[model samples]
Target: MLLKIGLVVIGVVILYVVVQVLLYKRDMKKTKEDLLTFVTKNKKDVSVTIIENDDVVLEWNADQKTPLASTVKLVVLFHFVKAVSSGAIKLEEKVALSDIERFYIDRTDGGAHAYWLEVNDFSEHATLLDVAKGMMQFSSNACTDYLIDRLGLEKINDQMKQAGLTEHDELMPLTPMILWSAYVSDRRRDAFKKMSGVSEEQYKSLMNEIFNIMKNDPEHKKALEEKMKKKNLLGWRIQSLLTQKLTKSTTNQYAHFMKLPG
Candidate 1:
């Protein structure tokens, strides 16, 4: 009687295991179908992958190139962390805010997201750690520009390449200010050409010169402003054009820097 009861228990356990396996397979099939349907309906050019226990479970266009956007900041942070480890930059070292960096705070516009430090949070100065935190946490472009200046771009690029991003070109050469300036210059190129009577190349050079003067020489900036005002060329709606060009990224790429558990 005892032997028969033991056999019945084993049969019940086997049935339960089979049922669980079947349910799992059904759920997986539904998940795949749903994902494919959504991607098809939305017409999204995306890559999705699922891995389990060192195995590729599902992949759809996983090899397609996707723009990293602010995700590139992870490379910057990776280098920054390395520099700190190598005794190149001290964590407590203070980074002073430039006039342009402070513009986000001074301007009443809702452009900057003060995640870690306000305009006056540290009185025109924040520690390297604070800047790093701001760059990652707030995605502050200005903070990124400052850190890039502190840690050479070439070093960051080398670090990224060594870490298996060898195929990604044009990922490390741009700083936040450079990207912003490029975007603005592209938007204003036509207007600048009409105003200066110069070719596209010449117009870009002149814009760079003007940008330098505005950032460095206050007297020259005032002169340029007065000249524009006198010539009635100061009323172009450049800001609206900028709005059209500053496209936001859909995903958070900064999280790529984190060392995940295996």
Candidate 2:
């Protein structure tokens, strides 16, 4: 009777273990199905990955690349915090708004400039911390550019590399002023194309020559005007473009490298 009872007990233990394994597999399958369904219904041309406890639970097209958009600001913020923690910059440090900085703000749309215009003091002094806050909170382009100048773009990029951020490769060279200038210039070019009868190639060539001269020659302003006159592109709109110059990870690899450690 004792031997029979022991054998029965062993059989019951095996049955319990088998049931647990089955349940675990079932749950995992359900979770994957739900995730796929969610992505299909909610996301449009987006790559997604879900990680838990250092493991990728679900992933789809995770290797695909897409525009970082405002998400890139997180990189800037990450570097800024590191700077503060390392005693490279102080929170109370005051930065007087330079003429160039002010110019960028005045000319660029929807960035630090807009925020500054709303709340800058009579003396135009703002702390380093405040500028960082403005960059994150207000998405201020002016503040971002200023901080980039202060921190040195190369150093920030180096830090990103050392941290092994694959996403940073596409997002490097974060120059807000240049970006704004290009944006405004592109719009102006589009407008020119629509409003003028000149051939697109001819117009582009003329603009390139004038910009090249402006960069290399001290008399670029005059030269620009002359070129524009020759091409019949000279106008307030073209001039404004110069002023505006002021104008992702794969499943397992992504999970390992993409997340920021606390």
Q: lDDT winner among the candidates? A: 2
| Superposition TM-score, candidate 2 onto the true structure | 0.52
Residue pairs in candidate 1 whose N, alpha carbon or C atoms collide under 3 angstroms: none
Candidate number of the best TM-score:
1
After superposing candidate 2, which stretches have Cα over 4 Å from the reference? 1-44, 99-112, 116-122, 170-258
Off by over 4 Å in 1: 1-38, 41-44, 50-53, 99-112, 172-262
Candidate 2 lDDT over residue span 75-177, tens digit each: 6666776776677887788877652253242333434456444655526677886676556555566566567657776787687677776554433322321
Backbone clash tally for model 1? 0
Q: Model 1, 167-199: lDDT tens per residue?
A: 454333222222232323333455544443454
Model 2 residue 21 CA deviation (Å) reads 44
Model 1 vs. true fold: TM? 0.54
Cα RMSDs, all models: 15.7, 18.3
